[model samples]
Target: MTMREIAFSLVAVAGLLATATAKAQAPEPFGRPGASDAKGAIELIDPKVLRVCADPNNLPFSNRAGEGFENKLAQFLAGKLGKDLAYVYYPGATGFIRNTLNAHLCDVVMGMPQGDDVVQPTNPYYRTSYAIVTRAGADLDGLKTLADPRLAQKGRHIGLVANTPPGNVLARLGLLAAVKPYPLVVDTRVDAPGADMIHDLEAGAIDVAILWGPIAGYHVKRSNGRLVETLLTQEPGARMSFRIGMGVRHSDQEWKRELNRLIAQNQREIDRMLADYGVPLIDEAGAPIAVEP
Candidate 1:
């Protein structure tokens, strides 16, 4: 599939915190009925329905047709809670939380980076990092980190999403000059940065591409064994990794705890779903989350 079709898919599962930029740093909590108060009295969300705020078109996460991994997981969780599943559809971009969660249209966002100030996070369900994509047996195959000297010494071309943490890491490693910047704000009509990067790597247009792990993993799964993905978690101070969790309104402490309980109760199932969708999950220590046999 074209990257345009799956552009938001990888980052959504990778927990890139891209949505964190679309809204204010500190999201306002839910308010009671008939009021515009920031600290309005709590309105209890109904437990009979697991209302989710999600993108209608984003793949590998959630879609209007409920085909994505997050969609499936939401269904499972809702079933476990003895609740029906519902969605508040919106584009997964700026103003997402403002229009959906904050507007009380939905009670949960299934994939938010932990520690995100925009939403109160549940206990992290998965961890992942940026990854380097290269030819499976190429000279760069053994490449583990952006600090590898051969990258600059051999004048290899690198592709990365602009203004992302990986881009900052490359710049700090003095490899910015050889890097090709892909627009973070892409026009789906004409640009597919992540997919394009993979295509270029296959065609030898770029020697390597640094991408979010979920994105890399998804594309690599379709690469016919031609691509190699190396997670960049070994680099000290790279800050290229993050843990992802469910998002709830700040005042929904009870709701958050309930979600956390669900997470703990079904972590193995959750991990299996992530693995099925090719999310490159890692642990707090940066080790891969192994899949079941």
Candidate 2:
């Protein structure tokens, strides 16, 4: 069988395994500090210091020193609520939500992607699109989006992060035959596919790359505009525009309501924060979009 067939089979098996696991597990509490218990009465958390969970070193998104976008957003929320701010730093990979927020180590998670399996979201604060990055002066300039027909031509290679929306979309479209899949998180070695993609883009080895908006934008700015970024069109079953919101315990309805209010009240400031982090704001139609307070 082909690689795609193998991948499909693995996915089917994984789904069955996940369903079996869920069936074997017992039902548990879903909400956070101020949420209702089994009896359905609301429990409230005393609003004091807003405990935010975030990554310690991920740039353009979050970090420990209040330098990233989420950190700034948390500070903004604290200022609005007249509360102190504290953070619990951890790596933002697979178990971030469950280990941090669900475990009650932190009261909130800044910049959690909407629709994530764990934690509950407040009002969505911003929307971002995935992008295709290429070398400066590459022929990709005429390609406005991922659906551009020119990509099907031979002799062109695109790099994608494995298991992400972009990768899955490409695979479904039969573009994976000409694309190189990379692991952005797992293979941290210097010669890994992700690092190689970056190096090759600078070296003009590949014609294009698919990466998340914030990551691509950050690299473009860091590269002094040596790379060109084009926002991709939304594909069916692809998470093109992701809504980022603050995550609270599922039981924290009071806090969630308060956060939603804060998000609505400060939409403009939040937009500015995301822009500061180089996240491209785009609308459902794939046009340039901005957030306003």
Candidate 3:
């Protein structure tokens, strides 16, 4: 959950990260492929199998059990493409893209920020934002951002991932002292901080949790009326929203286009799937889309 919420921390931690840097303003070193390249490199991908690189334990995204939304999406795509599905399981820590896609162990990444430099992204399928999760009907249910004056009130504690954009806004609001910070990176195989945060909130350890939208959405849906999640739209200094797309190696232009076609043809089904999983999807104008409570 560091900054962009995926791969940014991995890029830094891997040290060998040549791309995936936070320079979104810069053009992608590998631009989108033209229709001609689609025919040129179509052979690089297997015609009979759909391969995916994924974290073995990252919930709401992927897991070894094929229970996460991304896992479901991969299965759906594979069915549509008339191919058997395969997975390259990695820790999603450092070298996620390297050990999986670059090593030729997999063909696609199910979900990541649209403009990642290391991978050529297909058309974005969904958008989400950072959100605040709280116990239902609590006084803090009205929370919109960390900068809200109610957060500065006595005994009000906010839980957030350290080094994320929301953390920066809290610091500027002089609310850092009252924040319960979670680690930005950890062994996902053993830790689930977002779930832990929800547990703590229910147990009254913190008043609220500011989490990535997918994480918040999934957990809130499971909370069964005990908790409520809402997107944060009031923060000015931090970038709170992002669009997610499938990622492929930079050389796999034709594969990228194929994925894009799948995305275009299945967008309605994709939106419904994401909503069922409690993903807080939004449109380009910052308006919500296919989002469920």
Candidate 4:
């Protein structure tokens, strides 16, 4: 669940893991012999510190520069726990959880889908959707769905990540020719598809793009009011929104409980933080959340 970035797509993560250098020359997985890992023993909890496993270069999520929202969330939680914050850095490309959290290098991973089967997930802290991005004043600015027939018109180049939910919708609509595909797996160390998609949209290389909400939000905010991102909540067929939470080992029930409590107690603050980053939050009814989360 490098995302659920918080990649709502298991396909994307698997693609990255399959393509990255995780398979060859990768060491045998290592962690404390008696620790909670494949053996499922009790995890070693350092009550004095919060160690997080994060991609060193992913932004609007986490990065070594401490600018991503997950970095800020980690800092906030560590303060709430009265613990020092620490990080175990790696590219999120492949074998990330296996090398870090599963190896006992870190205790938590922010931005996972709530019910993902890999790591035990915490209570959802926020919910977001994939979104459509376009130039602020452009004709596609108010676009709400891939089913929009306007999309089939000539000259509407779409920059979409391959194999995503919206991609499916587009395919069903027979608008494949409109798409200028973006890759599912790239070196997050130096390449960001979301940013690149937004850049292309801005530079008119592509007239439209569909991307994860958080990624779209962050870049759009930095675009000097030149872009707009509309939530895909109204789309049909493909599920576009999901709840996001943190991840820990299954054996860490107490840890999960504590995190759940923190989430419950400070959800409003968390909402504000995500909103500041421009994340497109949704509610249970699949509507855009009110300004107040």
Model 3 clashing residue pairs (backbone): none
Candidate 3: Cα lDDT at 232: 76
lDDT (tens digit, per residue) of candidate 4 on 1-293: 13333243522331211112132123323334444342223454455678898877777787788987888999999999888999998776557767777777788888776556567789888877777888988888678878887899998899988867787788789888999998776677777777777778889999888887787877788888998888887566677777778878666777888899999999889988888878778888877776674
Ranked by TM-score from best down, the candidates are: 4, 3, 1, 2
Inter-residue clash pairs, candidate 4: 3-6, 3-7, 4-7
Question: Which sections of candidate 1 miss by over 4 Å?
Answer: 1-21, 34-46, 186-192
TM-score of 3: 0.86
Worst 10 residues of 3 by lDDT: 10-19
The digit string of per-residue lDDT tens for model 1 on 57-154 reads 54556667887778988999988888888888766566778888888788888887765667788898888888899999898879988888889876
Candidate 4 yields a Cα-based lDDT of 0.72
lDDT, residue 122, model 3: 86
Question: Candidate 3 lDDT, tens digit per residue, 1-293?
Answer: 44344445322211001122232332223432222333434534456778888777777777899988889999999999888999988766655676667666777878767657667788889877778998998898777767778889999988877666677788778889999977666666786677778889999999998887888888899888999988975587777776778877777766777889989998989999989978878888878874433
Local accuracy of candidate 2 as per-residue lDDT tens digits, 1-293? 33222222111111100000011111128544554452222433335667887666555555556776777878888899887888777654445555666666677767655554355678778766667888777778756666677788888788776655666677677788888766544311122333356777788667897766766766777788688887775676565655556666777777788889888988888877777656788765767776453
**Count of backbone clashes for each model?**
0, 9, 0, 3
Best by TM-score: 4
The best candidate in terms of lDDT: 4
In angstroms, the error of model 1 at 268 is 0.7
Estimated TM-score for each candidate: 0.85, 0.78, 0.86, 0.87
- On lDDT, the stronger of 3 and 4 is 4
Give model 2's clash tally: 9
